[model samples]
Target chain A: MRKMTKIDIITRPGKLEELKEAMYAIGVTGMTVSQVFGCGLQKGHTEVYRGQEYAINLLPKIKIEIVVCEVPVEAVLEAAKKACRTGKIGDGKIFVYPIENAIRIRTGEEGDIAIMDPEDVEK
Target chain B: MRKMTKIDIITRPGKLEELKEAMYAIGVTGMTVSQVFGCGLQKGHTEVYRGQEYAINLLPKIKIEIVVCEVPVEAVLEAAKKACRTGKIGDGKIFVYPIENAIRIRTGEEGDIAIMDPEDVEK
Candidate 1:
């Protein structure tokens, strides 16, 4: 483990199981989330009023990634800020980074206790 | 382009379109967000309280990731900060990393200019 700390999260799209149980109750594990489309202009990308070329829509979003090791990275950003809140306007965004390596692709174990668990990252 | 940066986002379940538009408006692309299950305590990991290892109800979640040139990292963060927010619970997170390289599958480009779009990544 050279030094690691990565916590990137996007929100909405139904809360992703309450922010993955609030980042696995603060202990974190392997993580990666996908499914996105957020090309700005405040959600107004498709337009062609005169001749008609409209139909861009594009907005749905969900992106989560966690690669811990930097001593829990502040408890996974305080349990993902209490599981990606909700008081208005989409509600999502947390970032922290400083990772040089993390490998466990079925057994390439490397760094920070080989990313925890798995029998202590293979004995 | 041998150096880059990475951002990862995770949150909610019902908000993809919004994220996409938001990111693009801010100028970013080629991100990944996938469905996931999170394990932890506060959410209560499945238990065999007594004689049975009860159901392991993993909380659902999503993960998103972005790798942009170092130049646009701050802008991306600012836009994301504004876009992903609610204010009560589960307020997702974001993290950035220094990338060593990024490649465009369509072309044989590697590093910075490779990830912007099909337009710049080509020879």
Candidate 2:
């Protein structure tokens, strides 16, 4: 069985479109995208709600998760960094974890095969 | 020193409310919730858009991510499975990953401490 790695990229929400394009360019066809609130080193900012100042620790962010077997992890990291970087504190972070298995619900395809695009399988 | 594991639960969106209640009942406080698309063996379903039938391979899913140390991993899994299972297809999947470290952005806390609730810390 091939080793599978799951990469979680939590970054600015505005970067989603650009990030998707970058991932596509790198042959990452399958990914999970979600909106998330990230509480990080930036310490967050204050917002005025109902004329009252409120310190919001959780800032809105976008998290893109991809489980990869065919694409090198480094390539995905590099592409993501270049696409999302703004040289700022809230630029976000990337996390890498080991995935023991991935199963397709409908077909029960597991591991690398579960995540591979059909075209890639044909190729 | 503690073991931190990240559990990613991707399941039916309808189960979110029940799942959250289950997690909270188990002392889970912090979790990142996001909307995602899952493409698996289910093969997807077709829908009519603008009088044209489109084969939508990707299905909407809710992905809840939690990094835990104080709460037992088994407990979380059990709660999730119970809340999500419907004895049918598209019930979703549960993925476990080893987390090397976790950091709290505001205080830069690490490991198990990063994920602990303030009230828990006091107790």
Global lDDT of model 2: 0.75
- The segments of candidate 1 whose C-alpha lies over 4 angstroms from its true place after superposition are A1-3, A6-123, B39-57, B120-123
How do the residues B1-123 of candidate 2 rate in per-residue lDDT, one tens digit apiece?
798888888887888999999999998878998778654421243533234654533567888988889999878877887788775556666666787898889888888888888677768
Poorest lDDT segment (10 consecutive residues) of candidate 2 chain A = A41-50
lDDT of 2 by residue, A1-123 (tens): 889899999998888878877887887756777777776432455543235654654777888888888989999999999999988556889999888666543344556875766445546
User: Which numbered prediction scores highest in DockQ against the true structure?
Assistant: 2
Q: What share of the true interface contacts does each candidate keep?
A: 0.10, 0.28
Stretches off by above 4 angstroms in model 2 are: A42-57, B1-9, B12-59, B64-94, B98-123
lDDT agreement with native, every candidate: 0.59, 0.75
> For candidate 2, what's the RMSD?
7.7
Docking class of 2: incorrect
lDDT per residue (tens digit) for residues B5-47 in model 1: 7765555555566677888887686788767654322232343
What DockQ was computed for model 1? 0.06
